[model samples]
Target chain A: MKVASIGLGLIGGSFALALQEHVLEVEIWGIDHNQAHIEAALARKIIHHKGSIDDLKNFDLIVLSIPVDAASALLPEILHQAEKECLVIDMGSTKNDVCEAVKNHVKRNQFLALHPIAGTEFSGPKAAFASLFNNAMMIVCEAEKTDENLKKKAYQILQKLKMQLHFMSPKEHDKHLAYVSHLSHVSSFMLGKTVLDLEKNEGEIFNLAGSGFESTVRLAKSNSKTWIAIFKQNKAEVLTSLKEYQQNLKEFEKLLETNQFSELENLLNSTSRIKEILAKK
Target chain B: MKVASIGLGLIGGSFALALQEHVLEVEIWGIDHNQAHIEAALARKIIHHKGSIDDLKNFDLIVLSIPVDAASALLPEILHQAEKECLVIDMGSTKNDVCEAVKNHVKRNQFLALHPIAGTEFSGPKAAFASLFNNAMMIVCEAEKTDENLKKKAYQILQKLKMQLHFMSPKEHDKHLAYVSHLSHVSSFMLGKTVLDLEKNEGEIFNLAGSGFESTVRLAKSNSKTWIAIFKQNKAEVLTSLKEYQQNLKEFEKLLETNQFSELENLLNSTSRIKEILAKK
Candidate 1:
């Protein structure tokens, strides 16, 4: 199968590598706005050739791996330019805006809105690796909207990459991701901001930074172009999640203020149930 | 030199294992408030024997590995009970309260306040492992308060464990830790609470849990006894950090509400500096 991977950053680049590793016959074409990313991905052999949306008609599969805003804008046009049998898939973090934008389009069936639940605190084609999707989830939102044959083909290719398929609606994907993915980024960013803002002598004091602080704030390192688009697209659900998170933080502070050690322990114990929930999964 | 590890949980048990691995002849006498923990550590050979504060006088080194509250409550008595040559060291997360409690004691010079900046979300003897302290930071607070000879011995032992030693005052340690260690736990716990509380069908929705969310919320699994004591002991600084964090979240919320994508991107870009800070360390 011939494939064109858009964006050429962490997710897109890694997808290209993983796809190439899993299926030897699969040919990946690189499409990225950044010339450096295109050059790096090409140098790394992450793709067979550099291509534009105009050239997408030559491929059987086109993966949209760009930022949500860019992907949302390009999806309809890409679908319009694609062969009727072409399977167009998205690997964006948020789903609502992009999915809704192309929902009523004439060639909508050619595009499958999907998110591969895998990444690291790094970016660029240089950050790409072959096993990024190994043992991770590939969330397919609005799968019913795609052609059955195309969905099956996409599933088989993802299965080859060792990803667990999770089905959800575009609405469900946006809501759950706001709580699960987007909110965590918000939490991590604020954590990094809080520490950096509080410490004026960042270089000296960062030596005092431990693994817990580092892990909790790691998502704060995410690129602005990608994440800013996600935050804007999933605005409402993200707002709700933040409010609930702030309320919890306020309550925790109150417990400390009142010297309610017992209550604080109970709260912490309740929260610790996340360990079991996470472990079981 | 003989060592008594006073808590058979993650930190204490791991400390014993790391010490035993580094120094084949070092004897670790285990002490714990939980009889089960003592038995478990003994069976695992994490300790040479199950001992107590009463047995501390017989050892050349007394390692206080208990929770902050228990360690805070016991430090004065442990120092008083310890032999003059026995150096008492603490591995508690927070230090100011414990240090202040014994500042006026006659045997204060024998006690050195220290924190190993290492741990997992898991707890107990089974979770303990050798090399846990390897390539990790060990903060020795108020080292000047301890006898110079005892401090040297402690430094040599930590060096054997392959840890980097950082010296700071008890006040500085507590304040800095409030921003670095303690605040991150609060962030993780509140994030877990926010998600758990909002999701009614948590077990079903948790299937959506990704690595990003899991990593950000991992500290929520920390044992309650250890963290409650930390929050209570360092209440003021934790509260200050929480307030600052909440303020940042509110500003971020407003940015999203007003469609101020540029400002949001700038904030995220600035916070991305955490990547550089963490990488250097």
Candidate 2:
């Protein structure tokens, strides 16, 4: 099987590496508008060859692993030109926008909207690794709109890469992801900005920052272009989650103002449930 | 030299283990209100023996590794009973209150206010480890209030344990810590609460949670009792930092609501400075 991957950055490059590592008799062709990324992907041996959108007509699979906006913009064009039996999958953080944009296309049934729930703080071709998707959840949204064979093909591919498959509506996925993933990035970025603004002395920041701060602020280093697109595409849900988070912070502030130690204790106790939720994973 | 550690839980137990690991001639005696913790510390080989506050006169050094409230409440009594030549130190989050509470004590010169910027999400005797302080920061506040010779002894001990020493005023330490450490914990706890509230299906949370969520929310599992005391002790600074964080979130929300992608991109880009700061450390 031949896989033509768009974007050829972190997610795409990593997926190409995973395919090379896990699948038998498979070749990956990389595509990206960023010439530097394509060059780096080639130099890093992230793909077997560099290809273009025109190559989509011949590949067995075409993976859209670009920014959400770029994916939404380019997907319909790829759908129009792809072969009937070819399986096109998008590995975007926000699924609803892209799914809606391509809903009425003639080749819509050939496309599968997927979100592989995995990543690290690093990005670009150099950050790609062979085991990026191992044991990670791969969400397939609006599967009813996809052809049976195409859906099966996507699932088989994910399974071969050692990913757990999940099914949910695009709307549900967007909402939940806003709370769990998108909001985390926003919170971390803002936390980084807050600390950086206060601690002008970089030496102090380096010396005084412990693991807790490092862990919480790790996502602050994520790609701005990718995150802006995510926040824009999932605006409403992200806004709602942000409001709730701010309210929680305000309540904590009020408790502190009143010196209500027990109330603060209760809040911390209530939120400690994350341990169980995360541990079960 | 002999050491008596009050509150033989995570921090105290870890310190005791470090003493055993680093200093061959030093003996550690555990003192805690909870008899079970003392037994567990002994069973875990965290300490050589068990003792009470009455034994303060016997030990060459006294380490207070309790909650901020307990440290403030017990410092005077412990100082009043300790030998003049003995060195007393605390490993609490806040330094101002502890230092002030003992400022007028007759044995105040023998007391040292230290905050070791090291910990894990886990607590209790089981969480204790000899290498907890390796490459971590040790902040010593108001060193002038400490006897010069005793301060030298404390510095020698911390230096032997391979920790970087930073000196700052208690107010500066509290202000900076509120932004770097306390604010991170609050954001993490609130994030955990927000996600848990939205994710009614525990199975979905367990399945969909990725490394991003795990790292950002790691501190949400911290001990509620210890954190509540810390929040109360550093209430003002925490409230100020929380307000700044909420403002940043609100700005991002506005950017999202208005489809100001550039603004969002710029904010995220600016916040990426955390990478440089962390990399330097």
TM-scores of the candidates in the order shown:
0.96, 0.97
Residue A21 lDDT (model 2): 83
Q: For each of the candidates, what fraction of the native contacts does it recover?
A: 0.84, 0.87
Error of 1 at A268 (Å): 1.0
lDDT of each residue in B239-276, candidate 1, tens digit only: 98889999999999999999998998888888877887
TM-score of model number 2: 0.97
Q: By DockQ thresholds, what CAPRI class is model 2?
A: high
Give the number of the best model, judged by TM-score: 2
Of the true interface contacts, the fraction found in model 2 is 0.87
Instruction: List the candidate 2 regions with Cα displacement exceeding 4 Å.
Output: A201-203, B200-203
Q: Across residues A1-281, which tens digit of lDDT does each residue of candidate 1 receive? A: 88988889999999999888898698878888789998999899998888886777778999889989999999888988889889999899988899999989998888888898889878999999999999898898888898999888899988999999988888888888999999999999989998898778534667777778888988888887889999998999999888988889889989899988788888888786798899897
Instruction: Give one digit per residue, the lDDT tens place, for model 2 in A112-187.
Output: 9999998999989999998989988889898898899988888887889999888998998898888888989999
Q: Model 1 Cα displacement at A227 (Å)?
A: 0.2
What TM-score does the first chain of candidate 2 have?
0.97
Every candidate's chain B TM-score = 0.96, 0.97
lDDT of 2 by residue, B1-281 (tens): 89999988788889989888887698888999888898899899888888888767877899999999999999999988888789999999999899989888888999999999999998888899999998788999998888999999998889889988889999988888998899999999999888877767534654667889889999999998899988888888998889989889888888888888887788888887788888876
